[model samples]
Target: MSRLSDMLRTQRFDDYRFYHQSTINQTLHLISAIIFLGCYALLFTDAAIAGIVGWLAMLTRQTGHFFFEPNGYDAVNDVSNDYKEAVKVGYNQTRKIILLLVWGSAPVALYVYPTLFGLFDPPTDRFDFVRHVGTLWLAIGIGGGLARMLQLFATRDLTTGLVWAFKVLTDPFHNIALYWKSPLKLLRGELIDSSIADADWGADEVEEAPHLT
Candidate 1:
């Protein structure tokens, strides 16, 4: 875990240094990709429209990560991202995009399903074009704002402390003591050795092994 720096505007790499690999995040990504693929298949004629939407999203995000928010991993003359600030910026941006995509999954799924099924039936006025527009805009705005906030954290912007403080207040359900203890402990290099989780039989803990593992 990287600690926040105490600076107004630290250099490119002074900011950003906290990390935790979450499988929930990976699952969300897989779901989003599968949803997009579903939409692509619904396009029928090779889904030229859905293809454009995906390509545009990809190009825009890649541009931000590679150029404007380049990771500081190699910037500090280190082997990889040694918990550097630039790398933090890149990661923060990635989170924002993920949030946007997560928000978008529902609407995109709706768009795809009805279309795929409707192919055999009469269409309903070519779909809810307005709702789709709203979803896209909402994803872009929310994602961009969140990404900026995370960038501020990396830069040691004065608002970093306030931002996290507000997050703790608004989303207290996330890091409760008993439930999320595993991930939090892992971050501190404390692995909670649970034989119940490791046991092959004789316990229901086997059902929830991944949560602790």
Candidate 2:
């Protein structure tokens, strides 16, 4: 009982709380979910329209990762009081943005076919448009979904990853479907310490940046 209390009281965890999914960010998630669902529906009805919405949603949804961001430093108050600490935070922020642009943007290009919205229609007679649409969504849901599963590594929380996969499997776009370490890490400034030196103390406990989730 005492150990459990100690664990609960540990300073590593914070008193931080988050609003329900009705909040603006969560609402955006809902909007993205609806769009993806609609895209799926349309993908079957007409490949051209489905491609347009899919690509558009892919662009808009992913682009927002940069526009709607809160510096994560606030989640963990800095006690370092060292001059270098603030500088480190500044450097980290810039790095995070760059990473979001590069590694995180792969899906945008990978799914560009859907994004193009049938600008260059794959010949209907030769190409099975419905097959293409289904393939794209399935790829995003399963293939990209697996990649997103890898992202749980950024959280360093295995259980959290499992739960996240279970929740977002049906809705890929809304889920961020990649382990976006930079954005979430920058938001919270929490990252896994991989230095061999730190391992001497003990294998670090699996930690998560809850705020980003």
Candidate 3:
């Protein structure tokens, strides 16, 4: 339990310092986290609606990473962009692009095939079509996460895979906790998170292995 907690903390800390340097990005993540909570609530009663909400949150979150976060050499972390991408625990930019392409194509494929080559029942109306798409999106989201988790199990260790999965599942609540003040910082005209430079997790604690994606 202690090891798991430590790894989770390290992953979260590394994630914040490496990726979330933009106040705008942090603020967007806060919003995305809230939306994800809504999706979680709807998951039990209406999975299709939850899927729609989840993707909306994902887009909001990714927009911040893609458009706002800096992608240059990390002066604070003293690592190159390529280094970070290579060691990233979860989806790096390249993998994210592929995942997004698959996500984007799902609806189009469903639209053209209607039944998606007999995988789904033909929708009776537009709403039903959307629901079907949402369901498929939900599956894709789960599959994407699980696929990465399994990859980690093969490449890293069981503990690393489990920890990453746990981190992803609980990220919404954690983001809200971590970034609740990000909006105020953005309002103060702080474009970058200056405090990230002060992050001191100790060099000995840094993971030598590749992280999740």
Candidate 4:
């Protein structure tokens, strides 16, 4: 348990220092985190509503990674993009691309097969179609998470896999706590985050840590 807690902190810290260089990206993550917290609250009362809102938060968070975050030589972390992606315990760029592709194609699949491979009923109207999409996306979201967790258990250790899953599930609350001041920093004209000085990423335990690149 103690080891899992430590691993979670290391993952979170690495994620923060590496991916969150842009104040804009951090700010967007902050917004997503808030929405996700609300989504979590609604999960007990209404799962469909939770799923839709959760997807929205997921979209916002991924938009920051896909668009706002930099993709170049990371002087801050002194590691190549390839190196970081290789050692990432969670979804790296390659995995993310595949996930995003599936997410993008989901609507088209629903449109062509209204029953959605027998998972959902045929939509009666456009609203129903959209609802079906949402329902499918919800399943995708949950499946993606579980798939990654299992993958980690295979490639890494069971503890690492479980910790990573815990980190992802609690990310909203954690991100909000970590990045609540990002907007204020942006308003103060800080575009990029300051460089970390000689921060050891525990490369012995975790293979690599990638910065905003």
Best by TM-score: 3
| Residue 75 lDDT in candidate 1 | 27
lDDT of 1 at 55: 40
The ten-residue window of minimal lDDT in model 3 covers: 204-213
User: Candidate 4 at 82: error in angstroms?
Assistant: 1.5
List the candidates' TM-scores in order.
0.30, 0.37, 0.95, 0.89
- The most accurate candidate by lDDT is 3
Query: lDDT per residue, candidate 2, 107-145, as tens digits?
Result: 354355543465334535424544455345444434554
Q: Which pairs clash (backbone N, Cα, C closer than 3 Å) in model 3? A: 89-211, 89-212, 89-213, 90-212, 90-213, 91-213
- TM-score of predicted structure 3: 0.95
What lDDT does candidate 1 reach at residue 141? 43
- The CA lDDT of each predicted structure is 0.38, 0.40, 0.91, 0.80
**Local accuracy of candidate 3 as per-residue lDDT tens digits, 55-143:** 99999999999999999998988888888899888888998999999999999999999999998889999999999999999999999
lDDT string for model 1 (1-213, tens) is: 123322212211122112222223222223334444544464575343554454444444334334433334442233254333234433345465675575556456546664434432323564454344434544554455566566556665546534444442222222222124444444565432232123232223122111100
The reply for model 3, stretches above 4 Å from the true place, is 201-213
lDDT, residue 76, candidate 3: 81
Candidate 1's C-alpha runs over 4 A off are 1-8, 11-61, 64-76, 85-97, 103-107, 112-131, 143-158, 161-213
